[model samples]
Target: MKFIGYQSLITIVCYLFFIFMSFWCIQDLHLERHLKMHEMQGKLLIVILSIVSGYLLSSFVLSLMDSLRDLIYIFKS
Candidate 1:
């Protein structure tokens, strides 16, 4: 595969891993009690929150790594 393909593959894996971790961790929060809506709505809210949090976290980590690599290249050259 090309470099772009490898980057895409890594991104997909990172997103999936972070999303699963966020979902698992969020379950312990019991956010359902805070919601006044139906059970379905509460579950939907949890899912949305997990996705948002995971995406943000994953993006930050990826960007930070990329930035560090670039910085290293600058010093090396």
Candidate 2:
């Protein structure tokens, strides 16, 4: 995969690592919340928003990289 060059692979790995860490942090935060219903709801919302935003940003970046790679290939050929 042309897009999977050494630097890009490293970046992808780092992105995955960040995703994993975010999930872990979300879980830990939820576990720390008290039994209060309102508190739980707020925390859940924050976690969901964080995850969704991260995913959207990552997808955008990956798509941009793919487009750039295709352009480079076209020029090379």
Q: Return the top candidate by lDDT.
A: 1
| Tens digit per residue, CA lDDT, model 1, 1-77 | 59889889889988888888899999787787776677788788889988999999899888987898789877787
TM-score of each: 0.89, 0.54
Global Cα RMSD, each model: 1.3, 5.9
In angstroms, how far off is 76's CA in candidate 2? 1.5
Q: How accurate is candidate 2 locally (lDDT)?
A: 0.66
lDDT of 2 by residue, 18-58 (tens): 56666666666554355445766767765775676566667
Listed per model in order, the count of residue pairs whose N, CA or C atoms clash below 3 Å is: 0, 0
Which ranges in model 2 have alpha carbons more than 4 Å from their true place?
A: 1-37
